[model samples]
Target: MTIHEIDKLTGQFYECICFKPEHYPKYDQLQELFYGDGKLINGNYDQPLEFTVQSYIQAIMHQIDDGNATFYSQQEISDVTEVFGKTAQRISVYEYSFTAENTAPWKRGVNYIQFILVSGEWKIVSMLWNDEKEELAIPEAYLV
Candidate 1:
């Protein structure tokens, strides 16, 4: 597939799954777009727990519910690169702005998502992300 089509699909990735929490029920469908069980690695573990799709979904929902958070997200797909012919990746600098009824705003982050061309369609294979912190900011190249 052309990189342009893949780019649009990447936008859909952010729109369908990341930005809209109401669509969380259909998250498994999103997961289905991935190759394996897949993972969303948020750097909270000492040994990098590979979160299966189900685990990630459950954790995300639980966090929102337990924290009483109203979650919102928007991503700017800053760059896309083809790893190999059928393997591609994109780095998105996103505004994951959310707020809890009793807490401060949620931190923004950058995500690196890899997609594999399975059958005829592109599917996400792995996703890794990290929140921008005071000590460690997003790199300049990732910016628009």
Candidate 2:
């Protein structure tokens, strides 16, 4: 019903994935932010990788288990949200790094997230994101 709720949920989305070297990610918290049929997609590569909420958590756990991501941090830099009745969408710009000590983010990306009001609470329906690359830099407008 309010943008503040949306903002808070988005903030939680970022928080649930971040972790320090001595701590594990709070991925379990994600289950509470999404609808039962929610989906997440990573479009960084040629072929988009899609996952259900549970699968997304498993994938991240696997990354940690493989030691590919011991410490990771991701935060939204900017976002634009639009609401219409019970549906809303947010295009968020984010920066992230695999190491917690990095002075600058190693990568930047955009996430297009869709939300719907279910039983008076907003829930994420789907989220799709792509990382910035050499030929595909983030637009200056989004950086602000």
Candidate 3:
């Protein structure tokens, strides 16, 4: 994707996570890329991934139980940086994370995430992370 296109798509993704109240309206679109073609699953190897996706969504919603959902809105967006080159299609992987002040202590951990250009827009396609441990370390560059 052109830098401009990537920027626009990246902004949309962040906005959806941060400020959009109509979060579920785009659920199908979001899931299509992340879970499409059974990509989130592994008929040959890993366990079914539907549970993972459901659990992930549930964890975020748990923040809403105590009125903490707005932290997503207050999240600091990383600069719109990209590694652009030609491989197959207009694909770029972005890394971003949000640290919630006053988050449930049990929920603290860094997320390694990636998004992809599905048809003409970027969507989160996969994410993996380590468990929350004592002394969770934020990267030096990410400290604001």
Candidate 4:
């Protein structure tokens, strides 16, 4: 997929499962666009800007436990948005889940999402799923 596609797709994904706390930063950026101050954004997006060595791994553990997720490819680094300004290409492997009768379990083997940088941050713009025959477009109204 093209860089532009990845950006749009990631934006859509953020819009989708946004009720999940970990995804809050994506909307935080959007709020920054609407509000003159970053206070509202900062207050709402509560992930800390830094972490200690052990806390860093702990954070990851906490995230996975809470269903914090990301899409990446085995062949490339997922564009988590580099702190420095630079563009890089990566392969894709998308993973998300569907709610079951009483709970939701992570669904694997969806697609490889391609991402790109816009305004100095990386955003998913496109998805290349292995199951091309059953691809789904996340609805805008579905986002909270």
Candidate 5:
């Protein structure tokens, strides 16, 4: 049951960020999945960019408003999750596209997500992710 709930929460995490041109992104829903003071980190560059939950939402909104990400969708291709007591973690392999109907993703990446059981509910406490670059390809094992 714990794993199931975690999976559902992760699914919701992805759902909140995806949107088509005609639809608004569900970025606000992210507040429900994150704990107080939850953070997200983007480690794709030389220096990691860290954000509080609200800041993360604002950043994505800015991207959309700037027309940089007018249409976007992201989904998990694979994940490995481990649970111990009230704390759990997941290494999720994901694929994303900027096009509305792309059969293949334009990019792939990995996310390290940390969770804690709070009041019998699983909530994301932190997440760090890095996109796959030309020199830093995702390993075959992670893809499977």
Candidate 6:
């Protein structure tokens, strides 16, 4: 598939996580689109933890119990590069803004995501990201 197509899928995957407040996470969608064994790293996590998309969405659901549900307003992909081989890799930089009611102001972050083509479709294999911080910020070129 083309980078453009993969970028669209990435954005949709995030939308599934942040925008579907009216229902339980569309975990089945994630299960098919992501590697059954995926890994995620974020600010709260101490290490890159491996998980099935089902478990990952379950974790997100737990956050909702605390009245936290972030919805994204914008999503941008940059620095896309593809390496076609036995396991094709599509890597890119992702940026987005999200906010939840009664939470801090809208926060933005730059992240690195890597996808591999499995069973003829792109599946996120691993990802790690941090909210924009004083020491490390999204580069100006990627701010678009």
- Point to the candidate with the largest lDDT: 5
lDDT of 4 by residue, 1-100 (tens): 3455445544554343233333432333343222121111111123523432234335544665676544211122133322223343333333333322
Q: lDDT of model 5 at residue 43?
A: 98
Ranked candidates, highest TM-score first: 5, 2, 1, 6, 3, 4
Ten-residue region with minimum lDDT total, candidate 6? 86-95
Which prediction has more favorable lDDT, 2 or 3? Answer: 2
TM-score of candidate 4 against the unseen true structure: 0.28
Worst 10 residues of 5 by lDDT: 97-106
Report per-prediction Cα RMSD to one decimal: 3.7, 1.4, 7.6, 14.0, 1.3, 3.7
Q: lDDT per residue, candidate 1, 19-124, as tens digits?
A: 3345443464666666888767876446666687878778767766775544555556367466578888878777655532335354667878888888878877
Candidate 5 — number of clashing residue pairs?
Answer: 0
lDDT of 6 at 132: 72
TM-scores of the candidates in the order shown = 0.76, 0.93, 0.41, 0.28, 0.94, 0.70
* Model 5 stretches astray by more than 4 angstroms: 103-105
Better of 1 and 3 by TM-score: 1
Number of clashes recorded per candidate: 0, 0, 0, 11, 0, 0
Regions of candidate 4 where Cα sits further than 4 Å from its true position: 1-85, 89-97, 102-106, 131-144
Writing each residue's lDDT as its tens digit, candidate 2 over 1-144 gives 469999999999999989987988897788999988589999987799999989988888898889887988889989989999999999999989876675754688999999999999999999999989989988887766
Pairs that clash in candidate 3: none
For 75-134, candidate 6 gives per-residue lDDT tens digits of: 555555565652444334554444444464445675566777766677777766666766
Q: Which lDDT values do the candidates have, in the order given?
A: 0.68, 0.89, 0.42, 0.35, 0.91, 0.61
Residues 1-144 of candidate 5: C-alpha lDDT, one tens digit per residue: 999999999999999989987887897788889999799999988899999989988988888889888888889999989999999999999998888775754799999999999999999999999999889998887776
